[model samples]
Target: MTTVGFLYPGHFAEDEFPRMEVILDTTIRLVVNRTEPGEDDRRPDTLRTLGEPERLAAGVEELRRAGVESVVWASTGGSFVYGWEGAHGQTTALARAAGLPASSASLGFVQAVRALGAARVAVAATYPEEIARLFSEFLAAAGIDVVATHSGGVTTAAEAAAWGPDRLKELAVAADRPEADAVLLPDTALHTTAHICDLEELLAKPVLTANQVTVFEALRLARRRTWAPQLGTLFAAREAPPAPVGWRPAGE
Candidate 1:
C-alpha cells in the first residue's frame, strides 16, 4: 500500500481522508499543526495569513520518521498566498526532508487540470474575491484559464469545515459557468469529495477538488496510479503511464 502523508490543521472534514482510502486503498498519516496555548481553535480568525516555514519543516521531519512515500500539505491558504515561487519552494523542501516526492493541494490542482486537457476552468470557492483572484493568477501561470469565479465570502477555515455536502453541491450549481470546460473546487478545508459524483451528474462535466486531486498526485508519485471510478472523472483518464518507481527529486 502507498503511504501518503498529510500536513494540515488539526481540524478536517470527515469525507476528506476517507476519499483517499476509497480511491487508492492507501494509508494516510497526518502531521497536524500544533497550536500555541492561547489558540485552542484550529480555525483561522480572519483573512489574517502567516508564514509557517518552521512548522512545515517540522511536519516534513514527522512524515519522514513515519516512512511516508509521499507528502502533501492539505491546506491551500498556507501555500497559495505565497504565490508560485512559495509553493514551489515548500514542495521542494518537503521532498528533500522526507527523501520522497512531495506536492501541495494547489500544485496538485494545476497538474490535474493540465492532465484533463482543460483550457478553461470555472472556480468555486469559499474565499473572498481577492483570494479568488490570487488563485486565478496561480492557475494562469500553468496555462489554464479561469473563465469564471464564484465566492460566497465564507471566511475562516472552521466555517468552511462546518459546511455540509449538500451546501457544497448547491455552491457548485451556482458557481458553474457555461463557457468553461470544467469546474474546480479548490479548498482543502471545504468538504467536496463526497459530492463529486453528484456535482458531475448535475453539471455533465468534470468536478475536481483540492483533497481528491492531492491524493491522486500522491498515488502517481507512488507508482500506484490506477483509476478509481468513484473518485470522479479525472481518475477515468487512461493515456499517461505512472511515473518511475522510487522517484526522488534531483539532488535530494
Candidate 2:
C-alpha cells in the first residue's frame, strides 16, 4: 500500500486529512507539531518556527519509522512565508531526514500549476494583503505569472480552516481573471479537497487549493500516477513531476 507522511501543525484542521485520504485513495500518515503563536503566534512569520532544524527532523523521523513512501511538509504558510529559497531548504531537510522523496504544500502549488500545463495563474488567499503577497512572490520566483489575486485578510490559520464554500467560492470568483488558466487558493488551513471540483466548474478554470495539491505533489514525488477527476486536472495528467527538493545543510 502506498502511503504519504505529512508534518502538520497542531492547529491545522485535522478533520480534512481523513477525507483527503478517502478522496485521493491513499494512506496519509501525519506527525502533528505545535505551532507557537507568539504574542501574536497566529501571524505569518510564526510559520518560520516550524522549519527549525530539530523540530522538523523529529517529525521526519517519525514518518521514517512508519515507512511512508514520501514526506510532505503540509503547511503552506509555514514554508511560503520563508520565501522560495527558504521553502526549498525546508523540503530538502525533510527528504533527507525521512530518507525518502519529499515535498511541501507551499511548493506543491508551484508543481501543481506547471503539471497542468498552466503558466498564468490567479491567487485567492485567506491572508491579509502583505501575507498574500508573500505567496504571490513565492509563485513568481517559480516563473509563474500571477494575473490576479484576492485577499480575505483572515488573520489566523485556525480561522482560515473554518471557512466554508460561500467564502471560498467568492474568493475563487474574485481571483479569476481572463488570462488565468488556473486559480489557486494558497492556505493549507482551509479544508478544500471536497469542494475542488465544484469550484472548478464555477470558475470554468482549473482550481488548485492548498490541501488538494499537497497530496498530489507527494504522490508525484513518489512517482505515483493518480487521476482524481473530481479533484481537478492536477491529478489526472501524467506529466513529469517537479524535481524532488534535495537536501542541503543550512549555509551550504
lDDT for every model? Answer: 0.68, 0.75
lDDT of 2: 0.75
- Give the distance in Å from residue 154's predicted Cα in candidate 2 to where it truly belongs: 0.5
User: For this target, which candidate reaches the highest lDDT against the unseen true structure?
Assistant: 2
Model 1 residue runs over 4 Å out of place are 26-51, 240-252
Backbone collision tally, model 2: 2
Q: Any residue pairs clashing in model 2, and if so which?
A: 37-41, 38-41
Best by TM-score: 2
| lDDT by residue for model 1 (1-252), tens | 456676765565535776557555434333333221123222333221332555666667766776677877766666777678877887887677667888877888888877777778899887777777777788888788898888857756667888887888877878888777778888777877667777777777778887788777776666666656567777764554242233222112
Global Cα lDDT for candidate 1 = 0.68
- Give candidates' CA RMSD values in order: 7.4, 7.7
lDDT of 1 at 47: 21
Worst 10 residues of 2 by lDDT: 243-252
